[model samples]
Target: MQLVVKPVPDTASNQCLTESCAWHGFDTNPPFEDIVELHYTGYHEKKKFASSREDLGEPLRTEIGTGKVIKGWDEGIVSMFEGEIARLVIRDDFAYGAYGYPPMIPGGATLTYEIELLRIEKPTSNHKLKPSH
Candidate 1:
């Protein structure tokens, strides 16, 4: 006799960034502590903040799950496989946070990063990474 419907909440909201961050991968994901070399462009509020290409001859290098990078990067990149390119939508809590990076990122800013996982070097491998094209 009566019908009522409630509006659905957006499940992809930043509240679930760890699970909601977008990623596309073709190969297998590397394990934690493995050295991963990647090329990435960071954007803040739709404006380009930084890019690995800006460094030239050197892409960003870091160990996944390590504390060397922002929490977002560690969490976002872990799901990626070698040669996978993706956009990682990172919440402010996972980024520079309230203080933010001076003269660049602002407080409570949600950042997006377009990254390409170029190579993964496990501890046992002495392989070198080639420049990204």
Candidate 2:
């Protein structure tokens, strides 16, 4: 399903991730893959009309491991390197879908997370997933 995307401001504002982030700028060169730890500061908006869910606050700290986080987080953080931060404007489809959570997150929630890449731990065989029969 195609979502109506809102254009993030070209100039970095207080409403954006951090002072140094390229808020709406595109990456000309992509970074290598590894573990990236970040310190995010942003808000989470609930799309659906569920009054139970609350708006998540800013400056939220999160850890992103390969395939261990939500799709938005996975895709959003991959472009960043250690000490790099960015504001991730996530659509509901990229977030929690139809199933709404009570008193926290709602269905079809669109959120914006200001993320910082704290560290990147290279993938090792010790952390590889074993095949399931």
Candidate 3:
């Protein structure tokens, strides 16, 4: 299994490259702990299997760094801006692994997803409340 990141041409200016992942587009930066809304299509061997846009009624909402999603998504989407759309080619190791995710995804699959960042809800500020009379 192999993973590769291809930066979008127009979003190159906002592109941030790392050893394992790359992100593009422009908007507010989303921290690892932030809850994000996204639309994604999942594929295996160039065939559409599942899509948040089609199967799910609403956009996928999850916390970034809490393992709510795949490892690749957590690593790849960090610091990504809201409204950014990027292609993520994730290896089995970073994804569902050799066992895969059961019937929907076969074993040892190399998954490709077109992830669109729809919105980001930052962690609310922690402030102590005053005592009531």
RMSD of each candidate relative to the true structure = 9.0, 10.3, 9.6
Name the regions of candidate 2 deviating beyond 4 angstroms.
1-33, 46-65, 128-133
Error of 1 at 12 (Å): 14
Candidate 2, residues 18-127, lDDT tens digits: the string is 22354323333123335444455435552333111133332323334344556566665654545654666766665566774445566876666665565566555656
For all candidates in order, the CA lDDT equals 0.69, 0.47, 0.67
Comparing 1 with 2 on TM-score, the higher-scoring candidate is: 1
- Identify the leading candidate in terms of TM-score: 1
Model 1 lDDT vs. the true structure?
0.69
The lowest-lDDT stretch of 10 consecutive residues in candidate 2 is: 50-59
Model 3: per-residue Cα lDDT at residue 15: 32
Task: Decide which is better by lDDT, 2 or 3.
Answer: 3
User: What is candidate 3's TM-score against the reference?
Assistant: 0.73
lDDT, candidate 1, at 109: 87
**With candidate 3 superimposed using the best TM-score fit, by how many Å does residue 48's alpha carbon deviate from the native?**
0.9
Using lDDT as the measure, what is the rank order of every candidate, best first? 1, 3, 2
Total backbone collisions for each predicted model: 0, 4, 0
Q: What ranges in model 1 sit over 4 Å off?
A: 1-25, 124-133
